[model samples]
Target: MTRGWPARLSSGEVTLRPLARSDRAAWREVRRRNADWLRPWDATVPPGSDARPSSFGGLVRRLHRLARQGTTFPFAIEVSGQFVGQLTVNNIVRGSAQFASMGYWIDQQHAGRGVVPRAVAMAIDHCFFTAGLHRVEICIRPENTNSLRVVEKLGLHEVGLAPRFLHIDGAWRDHRIYAVTVEECPGGMLARVAAPPETG
Candidate 1:
């Protein structure tokens, strides 16, 4: 169906678009430099499983195919037109569920500045509205305070702790699940994040 095609999703300074084969050079540069910064939080190959794919193009093609199958939206995040990271909306389940999960990473240089929250807001809005999803969730490791803040800023409710939920950094890591349903953000996810806090 290729419903969304991972189009250019923009919110203030952050922009996200489908990753391309041409992004190799720049993406690799940022990824390599941030290798130390991101490694501890990265997913690792499960023990005894077959070797994972080693090619970036192969990963891109798989994501593109998932988009066509109407199961995922994989995007490369950009700050002011410069590539900085990737945000992928995966594990899409339709039918009565209509749910999806998100995973993202940004260049360490762009750590703060509200980039991740806004980008997440934009993506959630698209999933709930344009893509007809009913729920979206983000799972983060306990020691990942920065990622923890991202979900907090967007006011996603804490679902619970998941023990040994994912394999990360070469070992099984527990995760804290945070989620928001369409009913929780009646004004829309993007608009909710843009709203000012109420004053007494």
Candidate 2:
């Protein structure tokens, strides 16, 4: 069985903590403000959907259950004293395969500010080093250029395409798969963060 891992992680300007009920107001505002920007790329929800409401309580319960089952880890992303987004490593498998799928979203206002990458790097380090996962995969809609750039910036390699991979905004959307194994992480994402920025 996968042992319990801590629910908090911090790196540079970001901190990832377990999602809490108190976060609802801030989270709701973030979602409300980013609604249009996020809609096309978001998972399908019913008409008149209120994700923050429908999913809030259920999310807490689900995270607790998944933590006990050793199959998922979810966190709220906080940067510079404000809740900005979420990051999750789901569908964890142990035994012969130590792997999980990565997913994340940032408030529209925080885009292009390096927050997601920092949070992602922290999460990747936790998964590979602390959680002992061998592989992590990120599936992104092919049209999400910004998200594609994130995975690429992290140095994950494109593995293949997943047809009808996910139901997004009411339809099954094609996604490009990218992966990075623990073995390939070398000095790890934390080290990569510390290294000098790549220059042209």
Candidate 2 lDDT tens digits, 39-155: 998887555656542667777777767877899887899987799998888899999999999899999888998888888888888899889899999999989999998887788
lDDT of 1 by residue, 1-200 (tens): 56556578888878989889889898899999999999999998997987665888887888888888988898899999999999999999989999999999999999988888888999998888888899999999999999999998899999999999999999999999999999999888888668898789
Q: lDDT of each model, Cα atoms only?
A: 0.90, 0.85
Q: What is the C-alpha RMSD of each candidate to the true structure, in Å?
A: 1.2, 3.0
lDDT of 1: 0.90
lDDT of 2: 0.85
Q: Which 10-residue window of candidate 1 scores lowest in summed lDDT? A: 1-10
Q: List TM-scores for all candidates, in order.
A: 0.96, 0.91
**Clashes within 3 Å, all models in order:** 0, 0
Relative to the true structure, candidate 2 reaches a TM of 0.91
